[model samples]
Target: MTKFGKIIRRLQGDESGAALVEVAITIPLVLLLSAGVFEFSNVLNTRLLLEAGVEDAARYMARCSGDWDTCKGFAQNLAANGAVSSGSARVAGWLPGTVEITKISKDATDTATGVQLYLSTKATVDVVDVSTDYTYQDLGFMSYLGFSNFTLSVSHQERVIGW
Candidate 1:
């Protein structure tokens, strides 16, 4: 037989299960890649939550620095408040069921005429609470793959408006 003929015969006589074997080996790798995507998305979600919570707390504190009760309430509202109520609302679902807002200080900056009170707030997020109550549709894949919740802390300082 010619060289071309021999090559054609070799190709036709290839093992029947070659494709099946390749697929089997690749399946696990595909699944792992998908899992990694899910995990990375979860991490991004966590970061966004941390950012939003910090912004809310800071804005609230900056707005009302003179009144202690109002400021704490505002800070608490920021810490957990409706921050979880708006936007993606996905990560918000993971927002700690109960968040604590601690005041870093209560002092005014600048002169008496145009005083800007500086206040700091911190929020402690509970991972367990997130798992139990988070509503991220049917996104249980990552959580199943050991993407459990963890405490996230956020801090910010804001200048209170008015004297």
Candidate 2:
């Protein structure tokens, strides 16, 4: 036999659960990677949902003029049921059962921020402030890793009369 054949035979003779070793080394790595993907997907989905919620809330607030309860109830309903993955809890936690409208400028001023809208919505939530865990729990497999909380917050303004 050739030298290569002899080396191959020698290696084969030293069989010592190489497959198990490879799997042992690789299983955790794969799980960790997959867990990260799952976590990111969860965050991305929730972020999308939140963005949608923001749009809906802003739109609804722009269209309607209520004391406070009316707008918050509308926001909760829109954020919760609108997305493919419901965000009722997140919205509620973010804005709380009762949303306090900090400001409602009819003629909004233009700034370097972004938009100048006739309607601006701002609500402070004093629920638990544990969005990270909340969304982490919402995740599928990442929950097994005990990642069940995070921080999520944003301010949005849209034009009222324009669009």
Candidate 3:
């Protein structure tokens, strides 16, 4: 055999670097999987927190008797900080301005039958929808993976009871 071919065969038969090669391949994959798990858990936790805040705000607004502007403002505060007034945000990087409060009024009567559309027999039903999108901040994992930051959105809807 040629000198280079003989050297190649000898190196391939050697097992000295086998464990090193395996470890070199395994460690990075393990780290990547671990990082993915951590990031997914973090995102899930943030989404749950945001959902709770949105539900609270939507429920509060549904039962609120205040005017439109003030109620929306308080709802924003509640969603972001879990309080009507100023407080710390529930999630990091979450701001009150990120919350969007929308009010939707559905016709109470069915157009075809001219009867109440809702089971509650109301002429009009109001719904409060609270929504927000949060930008997740990873520990440079996504950037290392050549990906941009991802956003998570949460929303809650409640029917106005006027109670």
RMSD per prediction, one decimal? 9.8, 8.7, 3.1
Estimate TM-scores for all models. 0.53, 0.54, 0.78
For model 1, what is the error of residue 66's alpha carbon versus the real structure, in angstroms, after optimal superposition?
6.5
lDDT of 3 by residue, 20-127 (tens): 999999999999999988877877888899999999999989989989888889988988898999888899889988999998888777888887666666567888
Superior candidate under TM-score, 2 versus 3: 3
Can you write out model 1's per-residue Cα lDDT over 117-159, one digit (the tens) per residue?
4333322211111112123333566667666655555445544
TM-score of 1: 0.53
Clashing pairs in 2: 131-150, 132-149, 132-150, 133-148, 133-149, 133-150
TM-score of 3: 0.78
Local distance difference test, each candidate = 0.53, 0.52, 0.87
Better of 1 and 3 by lDDT: 3
lDDT per residue (tens digit) for residues 1-79 in model 2: 9999999989987968989999999999998898888778767876766666656655655555554455556654554
Looking at model 2, residue 76 earns an lDDT score of 47
* Candidate 2 worst ten-residue window by lDDT: 124-133
Poorly placed runs, candidate 2 (over 4 Å): 1-13, 65-72, 83-102, 106-148
CA error at residue 63 for candidate 3, angstroms: 1.1
